[model samples]
Target: MTAADTFETILEMRARAVEDLLGSLLDERILPGEIARPARLLQAMRHGVLNGGKRLRPFLVVESAGLFGADQDAALRVAAALECVHCYSLIHDDLPAMDDDDLRRGQPTVHKAYDEATAILAGDSLLTLAFDILADEATAIAADRRAALVLALARAAGAGGMAGGQALDLDAERTQPDEAGIITLQAMKTGALIRFACEAGAIVAGAPAADRERLAEFGSAIGLAFQLADDLLDLTSDTTTLGKTAGKDVAAGKATLVQLHGPDWTRRQLDGLVLQARELLKPYGAAASTLKLAANFVATRRK
Candidate 1:
């Protein structure tokens, strides 16, 4: 098979693996410390997360760790934890108070499938579960590795990261931010977790700090590409194609790079970002091939 085909194959395999792990994690079985797993809350959480997407963040974790010959099982657990955090963000992002969307991944959003309160709790539970997974001995990583993972994820998901970025996004609706403001907001809101996804793999592998930094920079480049592609899709794609409300960005008057610089310019910028990402991974040679393709995938994704 071709390299692109290999990338797709690996991506699909990793996504399926994550899906199964998440399914098991969200199952009705209660762990030792938990008194009970509320049925409705679990159902809401599953609804928000179980609905299909690319599972790209988890895939990144697996792939990045693989580059360093890290333990696959440990990497998978880390990937799953990162996915929990991502799905939680999505659940809350679709809330009535946030994007107010009714759909996600072609399914009713958590708040739509369940009550608003249930959705909120579901998001909260998943967010908490992420750290739990990271800290749990079941993950089988060393203590320091686990601690590093926890700290990185906390920073990526906390007020200084994704949540803070969301707040800025909400504010942007009222007062449009400048180009620099938009970049910062996008980096925190969208790029932060992605950066962690890549860095987490290196951390799990106990790779050198320099290698971790390289992967993080690669992630930042592709994260920008991902957001740019998403913005372009919002402008050009339909709801059926996007699997969610399309043109909502325009309707909300949200500022994006695509809006700031026309689609043609945005497309060129995406190319440049992908090139930058690939260059960052060049030192790793062919081991970085999958990641290079990932950068292309992020830049060119339709949804």
Candidate 2:
């Protein structure tokens, strides 16, 4: 099969695994130290998370860890935890106070599926559940490794990372940020978790710090590419293809690199970023082929 097809197969398999794991994780099984899993809240969380998407962050976690020969099962658990955090962000992002979206992954958003209050609690629950999974013994990783994962994830998902980026995005609507400001905001908002997803594999396997740094750099490059591509799609693609609202960025007056530099320039930047990401993965040789494709995928994804 062609490389793209191969990558699709791998990605599909991993996405399915992550999806099933997330379902089990969200199930109403009263684990230790948990009081009660409210039915409505659990349903909201499931609706928010189980709805289909690429599951790219979790895929990165698993694939990055694979480079270092990390345990597959352990990697899956870590991937699930990261997916939880990602879904939680989507849940909160769709709130009336935030993006105020009615659709997500081509389905009703959590708030629309349930109630606003339930959606808020569901997001909170998913965010907290991510840490719990990372810290729990079920992950079957070393204590130090687990601790490292937890800390890294917290930093990635917290104010200095994704949340901070969202705040900047909200502010951008009011005051247009300069080029540098836009870059910084994108790095923290979209790039942070992608960076963590790549580096977490090294942490999972206890790989050398240098390797971790290398993967992180690769992630940073592709992370920028991902957002650039997304911006391009926002301007070009329609809602039917994008699953989410298309042109929402422009409608909301959000500042984006695509808006500033134009589509031609953004495409060139994506090419450069993909090349940089590929170069970073050269040390792993053929084993890095999937990751290289992933970089290309991030740059060229239609949705």
Candidate 3:
């Protein structure tokens, strides 16, 4: 297979693995003294999370953890927890007050599949479940490490991170932001979780501060690369290929690097980002070959 195809295969395998792990958890999600989970809430949660998503954040968690000899099961659980947060965000992001997206992962969005209220609750449930998974001793992480993971996830997903970025995005629709503003917005909105994905591994494995900083830089560079690639795709690709509504950014007058600087400039930026990410991995060498390839994939992915 080509490099893109190889990377795609690896991503698919990881996505499937996470999906299976999530399915197992959902099956046994019931806790003591509970008759059964409310069917609709559970169903909505499953609907929002399963049968869709690349599980990219989780993949980073697993790969980064691998670099430091972290336990496989612990890495997988952390990955799963990250996925839950990601899926929850997607569900909320599709709400009418948010993006009002109807399609996601080639299917109706959660609010469309179920009612808006149910979708909201489902998202809330998934978000909380992410923390629960992290806090549980079953994840095999030490208590202190678990607390650190929870703090990191909260910060990444909360006001100072993704939510803050999104607030900026919403306002940007009314008043456009400059290129720098766009960078900050996209970094927080999209990059926070990705950075967490990389950094979480070092935390789980108890890697040194320097290694964590390097991985964070790597993730931030690639995260920017991924967004630039996505912006290019939004400008050039069709909805079918995107698995969601395409061309909405332009329609919404969304402030994007592509809008500030045309596709040509954005492509150049993506190239630089991929190079930077690869350079960051040089210290780890072949251990990061797969991740290096993933960086390239983010830059070139059609979807």
Tell me model 1's lDDT, rounded to 2 decimals: 0.92
The count of residue-pair clashes in candidate 2 stands at 0
lDDT of 3 at 38: 87
- Clashing residue pairs for model 3: none
Clashing residue pairs, backbone N/CA/C < 3 A, model 2: none
Give the per-residue lDDT of model 2 (tens digit) for 56-75.
99999999999999999999
Give the lowest summed-lDDT range of ten residues in model 3.
25-34
- Tens-digit per-residue lDDT, 177-209, candidate 3: 898899999999999999999999988988899
Give the winner by TM-score: 2 or 3: 2
**Model 3 TM-score relative to the real fold:** 0.96
TM-score of 2: 0.97
- Summarize candidate 1's per-residue lDDT along 158-213 as a digit string, tens digits: 99999999999989978789999999999999999999999999999999999999
TM-score of each: 0.96, 0.97, 0.96
Report every candidate's CA lDDT.
0.92, 0.92, 0.89
lDDT of 1 at 160: 99
Error of 1 at 286 (Å): 1.3
Worst 10 residues of 1 by lDDT: 98-107
